[model samples]
Target: MQWNDYRLVLAVARARKLPEAAEALGLTVSTMFRRIERIEELMERPVFHRERGIYTPNEVGDELCRAAEQMEQAAFAAERKVLGSSSLVSGTLIVTSSEVLGAFFLSRHLTDLASYHPGLDVQLHSGNEVLSLAHREADVALRSSRPMDSSLFGRKLSDIHWAVYGDAKSSARLSASSDFRHERFVGFSSSPFADHMSAIQRTVFPDGIVSLSSNSLVLTASSAQKGAGLAVLPMVLGEQWPGLFRLTEPIEQIAGELWIVCHQDMQNNPRVRLAFDALISGIERDRSLFVGDSV
Candidate 1:
């Protein structure tokens, strides 16, 4: 029930090694061992099991760890509320979103917000994986799709469109069939839009070869800029990479909604609220750039 106990448990859960966790927390290995013993004694059960010198959490430990995480988040929220009620917004705000948005859309906005609220310290996590709000992985998330969690509150930022882009030199060689039948394609691995893109590619170039495939948008964009093949990159990416040109004229437009999501409980925290507004306003201001026929 103590914060120190929870910290020890969480650290152990993360490192999966007593010595590593002890070292991270600046505690002796013997002290960590005693703390674990006391925690287990107080709880009246063993939380972890050891096998071949490797320690792993048991079901009880896992459940307790989950509860501990929630408790820690609640405590942090309380501290934020007490500090926030005093006037200005100031604290660490963790925000996450897709890499494309993180790199392009969030770039200038984050810079501006820092200037506007110098007291506020913002942490940005940009990746493809959906960080869980329920698990307190992030304070706010800007994503192309909304999660199914009903406990979270979200609002639409804007609708984003896609385009088939390539280097100008490669674009010049492309033939405009209604379906873009002659263009080569570059695909990202495990794309959320894979099925849709597959159908579009099949409908367009039934026989064209797929020149490059990857999970990295940066790599895909770079390859497209090198005149490797056509890549359906975000308009923002095209703008970021001047060498890249729109290949499919009208740009293979895909209407995907951008959402700002946060746990209902954390939404009211001052730092969290400031970040939410900043994100929404930033996206709205750049709305026009995200849409239209081309970059």
Candidate 2:
């Protein structure tokens, strides 16, 4: 099947419905269906099972989808490599990091990095999910801990410290007491922090009274500032919010090093290298802030 047709099936599998996939690909539903039909006709078999608008990839479809993905990546890599040879550093730099890191740190510096290279496009995806560098999910990643993949190269830029924080009113009311069980707690919905929170529940808040829980640290910090409960937040973020106050010192076990990671193959690519260096320098210059030292 043609690359475009293969992509159509891939999109259908991903979106789980022909109509949605068509919308995403900017094609009419009939056009999308006809394209897939042509693909299946060429293959002499069905690739996907359809039920009530939901499309599930069969074995053949799965294989084709994998091949299609590899082809797409190869095409993109070719384009990137062509740009890499150009003296002018200009291309898309996809950087992934946690919501807290992106919002408080990297996002602010991205504009300046792009301005330094006018042709560069910066896509800063703020989420906790670790995108695979080896798979080319992102050009570079800023993470709390070093990547486990050997194919990746990384630099530890700074230490990220976590501390208990709450609204100023709660701090004023209950700051004297070390036993925080009397106060409501705010915690993450998921992360390596979940285990740290377990320790906290056992040692600090025995009642397990968590008033707010979310995947977004931004929301968690806001909740704490509004007096919802006490939340464990990155010091860089917690300190900047005037409504919030640190309830205790930075936690040690839960703290992790801030790392800038990327695929080893991209080390020589000018845009990737430049963006990577910019990230390291920016974070290095602001290292004290991440470590809870006020600038």
Candidate number with greatest TM-score: 2
Candidate 2 per-residue lDDT, tens place, 1-295, comes to 6778878888999999878999989999999888888889999999999898889999999999999889878876676466545566776788998877887788666768777778888888877577866556788888777778886778888888877788868777766346676568876667656766667655655765877787667888888888888887788788776788877767665677888887766767787788777877787667766776421
Per-residue C-alpha lDDT of model 1 across residues 1-295, encoded as one tens digit per residue: 6888988888888899988999989999999999999999998999889776566889988987898788877876665446545456776778898888898887767756667888878889998788877666787888788667887888888777767777887766664443555568787667776677667656555766787786777888998888778887777676577698766543444657788888776767777777777777887678765774532
Worst 10 residues of 2 by lDDT: 79-88
Give model 1's TM-score versus the native structure: 0.80
List residue ranges in candidate 2 displaced over 4 A. 76-86, 129-137, 173-181, 190-201, 204-208, 293-295
Candidate 1 clashes between residue pairs 3 or more apart in a chain or in different chains: none
C-alpha lDDT score of every prediction, in listed order: 0.76, 0.78
**Per-residue lDDT of 282 in model 2:** 86
How far in Å is the alpha carbon of 223 misplaced in model 1?
0.5
| Alpha-carbon runs more than 4 Å astray in model 1 | 10-15, 19-31, 38-46, 58-70, 73-86, 134-136, 175-179, 190-200, 249-253
